[model samples]
Target: MSTNLTSETAAPTRVALVTGGSGGIGRAVVERLARDGFALGVHYSGNKAKADETVAAIVAGGGRAIAIGGDVAEERDMSAAFDAVEAEFGGIDVVVNTAGIMILSPIATMDLDELDRMLRTNVRGTFVVSQQAARRVRSGGAIVNFSTSVTRTQFPSYGGYVASKAAVESMTLILARELRGKDVTVNAVAPGPTATPLFLTGKDDVAIAGLAQAVPLQRLGQPTDIAETVAFLAGSARWINGQVIFTNGGLA
Candidate 1:
C-alpha cells in the first residue's frame, strides 16, 4: 500500500493504531507511519487536541488518519479504538503501544500510586493491546512495544519507571514465542535519553547539555530516530522478532 502525503500518489499501504499518538515519540511514529502509506488511528489518553492536530496534519498532507481518544489501560477503550480503526481503514496491520507514564522518584521515596499507574499502563496495557492485535490483525501484522534505556543503565530516580518498562520487555518476548507460526512479529524498542517531554522536564539548559554530552552522539535522540527503527520492525523484517532493539544513540 502507498499514499502520497503531499498528493503525489495516494494508495493505502496498510493500517496502524498508535497509542499515545499525541505525545512526542508517538506523534513522530504516527507521522512516519502515515508517510509510509499506512492509514492511521492516532490514539490519545487526555490530549484530544494534540491527537486532533496529528490527524489534521496527516490529512492536510494528503495522508489518511483519524484522532481516537481512549485509555490504554482499559480494555473497553482499546476495543472501541480498534473498532474505530477497522471502521475507517479495512483492518489492523500494525499496533504500536507507546502509551506510558514516567513519574520518577527515588525507590525509597516513590509513591505507590505512581508505581501502580505505571505498571498498569505500561505493562498490563501492553499485554491487552498485544493480545488484541494478535487476535485481530492480519497474518502479516506486527506489534511493537516501548521499553526504556533505564533498564540498561541505572538512573537515580528512574527505578519505578525502569521496573515498569522491564515488565514490558519481558512480556513482549513471551508473546513472540506464543504467536509462533502466526506470521506476526513482536518486538520492543528501547530508547535512551530522548529529547521528548519526559526527558526534558525539571532540567535547565546546562543540565540537558550535560546529559547530552554524556552520550557519544553529543545530543539527545529525536523521536524520528526511534520511529525509524519501529518502521523497520513493522515492515518486511519477519526474521527479527522477539528482540529488544535499542535505539539509544550509543547511550546504552
Candidate 2:
C-alpha cells in the first residue's frame, strides 16, 4: 500500500466540518483533511468567495468538499451550517473550529465595544458551534477547538484576546468530560505565533522576526504545522482528551 494518504486512499464516508475554513489555519486544515480522505464542510463567516475557491480546489483535487457560510455566534446560522453539512455528506464525524480574531489591546484601556466584539465572536462563537456539535456529531467523532499559546505567554496587550481564548480552553476541557461514553474526544490546540495573516496583519518585520526567534525551534509556525495536530486529534489520538495541546514549537 502506498504511504501517501489522499482522497483515494481511505473511506470518503467519514466527514469533517471546519469553521473559518476560508483562510488562515482553517484553510490548511481543510487541505490536510481532504488528503486524509474525509469529505469536508468548509465553513466561512463572511467571505464566501474564498470559501468557494477553497471548495473548488479540493474538488479539483478529487476530494469531496463544500462551502458553508454562517456567523459562528448565531445559533440559527451555525445550526443551518450543520444541517447543510449533514444533508450533503450524511453525517459529521469531526469538527475543527479555527475561527477566531486577535485584537491586541491592554485590559485597562480597551474599549468596551472592542472587548464586546472580541468576546462575541471568540467566546460566544465557540459556544454556539460546540453546542451544535455536541448534539449532532456522530459516534467516534472528535472536536478540536483553537486556542493560543499566549494564554501561557501572558504577553502584553493580549489581555482581551487571551481572555477570549481562555474561555475556549475552559469549554474544551469541560466538553471532553461532558461527552463521556459518547466516544467523542474534545481537545484544544494552542498555537504560538504562526505565520498566518491573523498574526502578521499588524506587525512590522522586526516584531515578526523577534517572535520567530523566541520559539526554541528558531522559526515561526506554519498553518500546516497546526493543521497537522488537528488532523491527528480528529482521526487518531483517541486517548488524548480534555487537555490543551500546545502546538507551539517548544515555545514555553
Candidate 3:
C-alpha cells in the first residue's frame, strides 16, 4: 500500500483541489499552494466572479489554476470537481476542504433549520469531499479539513457550530487511520477568530477588538496565517497526521 511519490521520484509539479476557494481562508490557501508549485483547482459553490478573481490572480502571478463550481455537500458536485482537477492536472495530490458556514445560536433556542444547514455544509460537506480525496489523491498527498478553535473553547451560543466541527475532527482522524500505509496524511486546521469576512460580518468594532485582545497574540488571525499551516500539511508535513493543528494564536 506504500505508493509514496516523493518529489525526488514524482512529477515536477503537484496538483491540489481547494474547496471554497472563493472565500477568505480558501483564497489564501489557493495562492499559497500555487506559489508552492501546485497546479490548483479552486472550487467555489456560488459566486463565480470571486472564484474567477482568485484564479486570475494566480494566473497573473504566473501560477497555474482553474476555477470549478460545485456544492461541497453534494457528492456528484464534489466528484465532478475532483474529476475536473484530475483531468486537467493528470492526477490529484492534495485536497483542502475549507468550505463551511457558521450560524451561531444557543442549542436551547437555536433554529433547527439553521442547525441542519450548518451540519450539511460543515459536517456532511467535509465527509463528501474527504471521500473523494481518499479515493483519488495520489500517494504522498494530504487532505486538510477546516475546523474551528471554538470546538476546544466551548463558547456559549456556539453549540451548533461546535458540533459540526467536532464531527469534522472525528472524521479526519478516522480517515487518516483508514488510509493506513497509503502514504496520505489527513488532518484538520482549527483556527480562532480569523479576520475573514465570515468572522467579521455583523460584528461591531468593539466585539472585534474584544476577540483580538482575547488572543495572546493580541490580534486576530489573518488568512495568510492559516494558509501557512495548510501549506505545511498539504506539502511536506507527512509525519503530522490524524491530528487537529490549532492555529488560534494561543486563544485556546
- Report the lDDT of model 1 for residue 22: 87
After superposition, the stretches of candidate 1 with alpha carbons farther than 4 Å from their true spots are: 1-12
Give each model's clash number: 3, 0, 0
Cα lDDT computed for each candidate against the true fold: 0.89, 0.94, 0.94
Local lDDT at 176 for model 3: 95
TM-score of every candidate relative to the true structure: 0.93, 0.95, 0.95
Query: Across residues 193-226, which tens digit of lDDT does each residue of candidate 2 receive?
Result: 9999999998999999999999999999999999
List pairs with backbone clashes in candidate 1: 1-13, 2-11, 5-61
| Model 2, residue 69: C-alpha shift (Å) | 0.5
Given candidate 3, what's the lDDT at residue 196?
98
Question: What are the per-residue Cα lDDT tens digits for candidate 1 across 1-252?
Answer: 544365455544699999999889999999999888899999999989999998999999999999999878888989999999998898999999988888878999998987998889888888888877888888888999999987988978899989989999999999999999889999999998889997788879998897788789999999999999999988877899999998988985
Q: Indicate the worst ten consecutive residues by lDDT in candidate 3.
A: 5-14
Candidate 2's C-alpha runs over 4 A off are 1-12
* Native-to-model Cα distance after best TM-score fit, residue 239 in candidate 3, in Å: 0.7
Per-residue lDDT, model 2, residue 242, is 96
Order the candidate numbers by TM-score, best to worst: 2, 3, 1
Off by over 4 Å in 3: 1-11
lDDT of 3 by residue, 1-252 (tens): 779997788866899999999889999999999888999999999899999999999999999999999999999999899999989889999999999998878889999999999999999999999999999999899999999999888988889999999999999999999999899999999999999998988789998999999999999999999999999999779899999999999996
Q: After superposition, how far is residue 204 of candidate 1 from its true place, in Å?
A: 2.9
